[model samples]
Structure formats: C-alpha cells, structure tokens
Target: MKTYVCPACGLVYDEAAGLPEHGIPAGTPWADVPESWRCPECNIGKTDFVPMEL
Candidate 1:
C-alpha cells in the first residue's frame, strides 16, 4: 500500500495501516479517506497531505 504525509507536520497515513481508532479501517485507500479528516498530530486537513515518495 502507498503512503501519504502531511506537509505541515510530517504525519503519515499508510494505506495498509489505516487509523482505525479514528474511524478509518485497515486497507482503506487514500482515496477513501474523507477530505475532512485531519492530522492527529498537528490538526492539518487532508488537503495538505501529499503522496510520500516510496
């Protein structure tokens, strides 16, 4: 699975290890994650997340 990172705080979102505690389950693709979702570390919106290289 691919990964994404928040540009502002470096919080990562791995598609294979979804944040289940926050309502996202394992295997959830980045495309499925809601746009309203925010980084737990810095509270940055998903719009600011970028695909992580490798």
Candidate 2:
C-alpha cells in the first residue's frame, strides 16, 4: 500500500489502513480520497500531502 504525509504537520496517511471514522475506508487509494478530506491532525487538504512509499 502507498503512503502519504502532510507536509505542514507530518501527518501520515496509509492506504492500507484508512481512517474509517473520518469517512475514508481502509484500502482507499490516495487519489480516490476526496479533496474535501482534510488532515485530522493539521486540518490541511490532500494537496498538501506527498507520496512517501509504495
């Protein structure tokens, strides 16, 4: 699974274990995640995140 991290606050987002309570189910790809879904840690948008690994 791919991983993404918020540049502003270093919040990690893993596709293998998505935040279901936040409306993002597990296995949800980063590209599939809605633009409206902000980082729960920093409140930043997905655009602020960058791919970390496969």
Estimate the TM-score of every prediction.
0.88, 0.85
Which residue ranges in model 2 land beyond 4 Å of their true spot? none
Q: Which candidate is the best by TM-score?
A: 1
Each prediction's RMSD to truth: 0.9, 1.4
User: Which pairs of residues have clashing backbones in candidate 1?
Assistant: none
Per-residue lDDT for 1-54 in model 2, tens only? 899998999888899999898889999998899988899988998988999964
Q: Worst 10-residue stretch by lDDT in candidate 2?
A: 45-54
Predicted structure with the largest lDDT when compared to the true one:
1
Q: Candidate 1 on 1-54: residue-level lDDT in tens?
A: 999998998888999999998899999999999988899989998988999998
Scored by lDDT, model 2 comes in at: 0.90
Candidate 1 at residue 18, lDDT? 96
* lDDT, candidate 2, at 26: 97
